[model samples]
Target: MNGYRFYTAASLLLLTALFTACQKSAPAPQEESGVNAETEIIPEPNAGSEKPQLTVAISVDIAPYVMKNATTGIEVDIATQALPGYQLNFIQLPYEKLQSAVAQDQADMALGVQKFKDVEGIFYSENFIDFVNAAITKKSANLKIEKVADLADHKVLTWQDAYLELGPEFEKLFAPDSPQRKNYVEVADQSEQVQQFWDAKDVVIVIDRSIFNAISQAKGHKLSEVDYASIFPEATYFKANFEEADVRDAFNAGLKKLCSSGEYAKLLKKYNIELPNTICDSKAHP
Candidate 1:
């Protein structure tokens, strides 16, 4: 009887061990396993990964190159067509503030910088456009101001923040006694100055030729010609940060393609701008 009981206990122990082994060997239930079990190995979500975005900055004041149309508050059709991959954001800053904005990373690029040497930590592409500076006054004033130095006794108005070298020239000719040669009243913007000149015939307004022409055409104002041409020889460019070499390269490639294909000429014509041959000769033509 004792031998039989020991055999029964050993047999029961062996059976329990086998049952535990079978449980351990059983396959786990996979939540994703279905008709297509191969697709169960899905990739894990990566929170750190993201697509890179390119940003470009431009000024809002330079007409034709940049301007706020009555229909569209801000127009960037040229840039949009040029840099299709970039996400463009115009900062609408003043000319003086544009350089600082790009340097401080507030903007990735600045458009309409005529001279590359003037800005630091920024790389400029080839010149796209040229501008001519001119003086405007009422038709009745009939001001015969020829050279920049000729506006000595007359009250002149120009953009306040602009670097108007002509002001100093006028001061040297007129107000030698006054410190800083206080010659004319500087206003915040060209439009304001032009309006001032319009209201007060005594004041003379100095502005860019393209702007003067557009304004005159739009408002039916008469623009008189000065003897001297204020055409700047340097061409304007799309300025990018020094670190953004790739973006600059892409833009240059696109611009070169556009120039070669005569697309640039089409753009100029679309804006009603006439390109002068003097731009290629490094000389200013009237």
Candidate 2:
């Protein structure tokens, strides 16, 4: 009986030892395969709101559009009022240099530009005004050069930068082989061109009617007008871009508002600019 009891006790002890060994040897259950544990994340800060402010550029050749006044300094004020938020800067470059300044990004935009495909990169705003090219001479020159062809035999003087627009017609009328081509002389500015004509009886200066009127009124000079319909039948003026499209659009819209409300006319009169017969519609040409 004693041996049997000892055997039973040993058997119970072996069972307990086996159960504990099994519990110790068992592997721990793992998280689902390929599943990531939940974790908190902090976002990075945004940087787009720190962009630098931009400036708009305008040429000073065209008065009222972008010119300085001797007394009031109202030209810049009007332009600033037209464009509210962005900064407006003026670079008083000659008409011919305006396009280049925009193309080279030296200026943000020009007040006006003649449409030319060579300057395709720069965008244009709405037609703010119509420009008429005319010949201004001393009341005595009496040169009957009404048509482009009529200028062949006469000594013609024009603004240096203006030749690009006028040279082709002049060349077409007076071919290189023609003797009349020799009479053409291009000068730096309208004032200089006018001086050239003033100093000589045979010379005639060609300029835009607006410029002619402004200068004549300012200096008390009298100019003889010649018919310019043959040269510029439907010339229009557009603002140009050195920057982005949105900025150009804003300026154009402001200009349209000014024109529609008759504020533009008032400004022109304030500067003593004569209103031309042609009116400007705010539509921008594609």
Worst 10 residues of 2 by lDDT: 64-73
* Predicted structure with the largest lDDT when compared to the true one: 2
What would the per-residue lDDT of candidate 2 be over residues 117-210, giving only the tens digit for each residue?
6466677766555556775555465667666776667787765545456546765654556677577777655655555666787666676666
Q: For model 2, which pairs clash?
A: none
Per-residue lDDT of 252 in model 1: 65
Candidate 2 regions exceeding 4 Å error are 1-57, 60-78, 118-121, 161-163, 166-171, 174-180, 223-231, 234-236, 275-279, 282-286
TM-scores, each model vs. reference: 0.64, 0.65
Give lDDT for model 2: 0.60
Give candidate 1 misplaced runs (Cα > 4 Å). Answer: 1-52, 69-75, 114-120, 164-181, 220-243, 278-286
lDDT of each: 0.56, 0.60
